[model samples]
Target chain A: MRLLLTSATSEFGRTVADLLSGDHEMVLTDQTRHAEGHPDVVACDLGDDDSTDRLVAGIDAIVHIGHGGHFSSASDLLDVNTRCTYNLLTAVRNAGINRVVNLSTLRLLDDYPEHLTVTENWRPTPGVEPVILSAHLNEYVCREFGREGGIKIANLRLGFPLVAGNTAAAAASGESAALAGDDLLTAINAALTADLGVNAQSTDAPHPVSFRTVHVQSPFENGRFLLKGAASILGLWEGQGVA
Target chain B: MKILILGGNGMLGPWVVDALGDRHQLRITDIGEPPETTHEWRQIDVSSLDDVVDAAEGMDAIINLSVLRPHRKIAFDVNTRGNYNMMVAAVTHNIQRVINTGPHYQLAGPSYEDWDFDLNPDMPPQPGTRLYAHTKALGQEIDRVFTTKHDVYLQTLLFYHLYDPGDIGNGPGGSGVESLGKDMMTPYSIAWPDAGEAIRCAVELPLERLPSRAETYMVFADVPHSKFNNSKARGQLGWQPRYHLESLWNKR
Candidate 1:
């Protein structure tokens, strides 16, 4: 599938770009012109609907990095996540793009006690920090579009402090939760392709909206965060992660 | 109580001021200078974090009536970021209460209003298409997050149509229209003073009296239109509307 990877210059964006590059056709876009730019990257501020529309044309899917996605002010962070996501999804609907994978963080649920197993259905307690708050705002905008039945979004609230390799994973091992490179890729790839109707054969299935929030994390040995929501809604198996 | 009112110069600002002014001290802030009033006013932009934090200093609570309806950029700036800033300030200052206001459509946009009746505000906000509704909904969601995390009591008063007592109900040949999608959306109706009273109720209600840290109340009067309900406001906040908006729905 031809994918449009937004905020293409961020570390998270670059990681996803590197991971997904082998299989899919990637069209990278940054909100602003980057000094160190990628060959596949096209700079476009998503707040401008016309430019965003032009950028999204001919794309099969989008990997929207919901957080650490913008290279702008904290105020613009709110716009890029909420209004720009709204603008981009509006464009996606206009362009008839059916599927989108929005990268979010499991830290939004960090407020929950460690002993209690957390799932996607639980209300995210993404308290007042701007980046987390902004990403939370992104889910709100994307879900509304899904409720409108215009676009289908797979919102992945992945684990905290996304690590690069085995060594870095080892370095950050003691942390509450962490997502390694391969697990992140597997979740995104699954989200991009999984049928939202995998279980719901009947027309009146209880799918509230075209959107599904799945918790994705590289749950290493006896990890507390559950991947059941991802497995059921997105078909991403627990075994497939980097455990 | 010494309350800081952000975007306190908008349409609902004066009404809120009128309702709470005599009872509590107010430090109101808006992007532009407020209308000639004796209330303490400051030229503050809610979108600016510094501006909001500065104005929130030494305040017991905050009332965010700041809203921008047009221009996508400014709309998001004031409606969404403004709320984020307010929540951050509320947490920073340890202010215990916030009275947030927005249109009813922010929760029940065209999708809810067009499809369902007896609509209540508690329904998970489905603010589908309208820009104003969408932005304000995002703001309200931010407030919910803050209330969940902190000790702040978030009383969001959702309004739709603001009517005056003396003004004539102008509908199709003076017949009541349940809702007006005619020029723009006025999905529910409440007198400005009644809306103010609802804010006052929220402002003064004992924190223990609130069911939760975060509660949303639809603030319109009991009009004949069966579109939206304010049972939550009445039952929860003990809000009572003085004007029933009889001309708009009842036979004159």
Candidate 2:
């Protein structure tokens, strides 16, 4: 598939592009202008509708990994994060792209009572925190698009995507919310290829919303967010050597 | 101060109107006719930008109490778009303060049956599958955006279940199946009077003293194995609930 990987300059976007390069044709983009010699990367700002439309025109699918950094002012984050995502979705619809992968955060489940196995179905505690609420609105954007039909969205609610060697230390520091790079790659790949079977009559079958939120956390014994539907939906547990 | 209470005709709206009416100049607006009240009442639909902007003119602050049933179209209209309209109107009119009412579904699991632990205001919102919760969560985001950009003070008070024990066996009773546990609900439910007090505190608290321009508080009476931590309301807003689940049983 020809894939559009947004925010390719960010750590997560770059890593995902590199990992998926072997199997899929990749188109990389970010808000920053691309270097002159790198013809393979497309310089696009998702906040601009025309730029987003041009970038998504020929792609078969999209991996939306862009976000305003942690230091952005609250208003800036809200505008850039939401407008960019909304713009991308609108362009995706106009461009006739059928599948999209939105990167949501595990922080949405951050306020749940500890030790209770958190599921995708848990309601997020509402608040005014800019980044977290932005993530929430992003999911709503995906849902709105999904409701419009002809689009399939997989929202991966990821934990801290840490470097391979640093995972142990981060986990040990009582923050059991870090995801290994390999796990993140596997989860995305599964999301890209999974047969959602939206028409199945069983209650467990994926709903017709065509938009699903799956928790993607490394299987830590004491992790705060539970990876309930990730294994069955994304096949993240298939060969990870974890249960 | 002139306070505009949007959705002031709903279930909890009357109680809030009663609580704050004498202390402040009150103006109530709702799509339906304003319930019998001496305060200035206007029939306005919050989803209409024109209506909200007109009603918001010269108001000191807005107390948004409007909510819609979980039906998809109406929920999106009244909760999501209505909030956007109100925020824009508030900013346009230079109204600096807005208090939004949201539900505790943000903390509750998929349903009341799946609830497990106490949630604090600092936690992220999880609206799950309910349309009402999802729209209300989106409205809270509108609050954040407007507060950040327009320098408005926005506070969202997320209420759990609100009910009077006296109404339990009288009319059309509570919804839910028989297998549902009372224990799961008792901790999260709030008496109507206590819920009113929380709203009053949110409206009257001095904004300059608040820790942040945007804030959220969980308002509920003290219940056993409660799923919400009310310390922020207590320490920040100086709010305390005089009722509890035991108060309902004790009345017998």
Candidate 3:
């Protein structure tokens, strides 16, 4: 499947683009042409309207993972994080491209600890402070867009999802190995390339691809499946040689 | 299936073990030796994840009811990290469900100093506090992460302050049961049976359907002045707390 990756110049995004470019037809987009590494590059700023229009034009699905980590102010972060995501979804709707795998951080509910158990029904505590509220606003946006769009949207709330190093090994630093930089790529690959029989491990990345939606489906393993074996059903690993 | 109560010697732990023991295999553990009961007993410290993992092995589910009081680091280590380690072990072993007794502070967000006891999980946690509340908030977050990311069916029930009338000597002020020193109990209210019922719901409900984050249930008997809201427990989990101030206030 042909794909468009936002923030293709990012360290992780670039890595994903490189990994998928060999197997899938790919187009790269970013606010600026930071790196000319990809054959198909589009200079479009997500902050602009025209960029949204152009990005929605021809892509089959999107790996929407572009944004600055820090913000100048609380409002700026809210606008960039929440509005940028909304714009992407709206653009996708207009472009008629439905599948979106939104890359999110563990910070959506970051104030909590690693052991705390929250189910889908447990609503996050209402936000009071500006920063906390902003973080929540980001999550609220995703939940709303995903619910209304009727698109296949998978929001991965990564738990210390690692890029390359061992987050757990820094044991004292509380950092260790995490979902690889290519983990999202693997998720996209599963969403696009795999067939029904795809097992856990594929040529694309480590860990078997099992994509589950947290919205409607009961978190229970035995409950109704929103999209069972979505990773394999989408043929996310079909082109990869990781058999 | 064997059920283990990690903080079995504490206020709610023993009661929960008693309430559920008739039908389930009950095992009790704590920093101290488990009290004598029909259920099997073990001495364990859940703060050490390995020990918890070992104790949790082969158990159907593990309920954590232990906590360190007043000590910030201790509370954090036990409530947050300790909870994580226990859940990690539980998830790795594929324990069916893990029930935790989350602190009431998660609901303390919207509450004021005078209103601290009236917390509801739905309210944002009260901010800028020192001691137990902060540690508990961290613990609740950890609960959210593990239940969501690791696929552990975690149920966290936030309990109100517990009061045992039968044992007033145990009260903080060293007051005797018959000759109550002062009538301050009106302000600090908790119905033990109601608390047990809420706890029962937590253990029985399909945890995965519930959010993995901290969830709270008020333990007070229905009182005109009761500040906690436990309707969610009643509506969703089929829990009905039997004791109320009207029922227990003048009886004893």
Give the top-scoring candidate (TM-score).
Answer: 1
DockQ for every model, please. Answer: 0.73, 0.08, 0.02
Off by over 4 Å in 3: A1-243, B109-119, B165-188, B206-215, B247-252
- Share of the reference A-B contacts seen in candidate 3: 0.00
lDDT of 1 at B35: 70
Which candidate ranks first by lDDT, i.e. highest? 1
Return the clash pairs for model 1, or none.
none
Query: What is each predicted model's overall lDDT from 0 to 1?
Result: 0.81, 0.72, 0.56
List, residue by residue over B61-89, the lDDT tens digit for candidate 1.
99999999988878888998899899889
Ranking by DockQ: 1, 2, 3
What is candidate 2's TM-score for chain A?
Answer: 0.82
- In angstroms, how far off is B150's CA in candidate 2? 2.3
Off by over 4 Å in 1: A33-40, A70-73, A161-177, A198-209, A219-221, A238-243, B169-187
**TM-score quality measure for candidate 1:** 0.88
- Per-residue lDDT of B1-252 in model 3, one digit per residue for the tens? 578788888777777876787778887888886587877888887667678888887888888888876653456557655665676677768886777775555445323435444445566555223345544555555555555455567666776556664444432343444524333444335556556667677777775557543455544445454455656667666787554443223435
Best by DockQ: 1
Docking class of 2: incorrect
**TM-scores, each model vs. reference:** 0.88, 0.56, 0.47
Across residues A16-130, which tens digit of lDDT does each residue of candidate 2 receive? 7787898899988766543234566787767434777888888988988633233354444544455566668778878888899887787777776766777888875534456
Report the lDDT of model 3 for residue A195.
Answer: 26
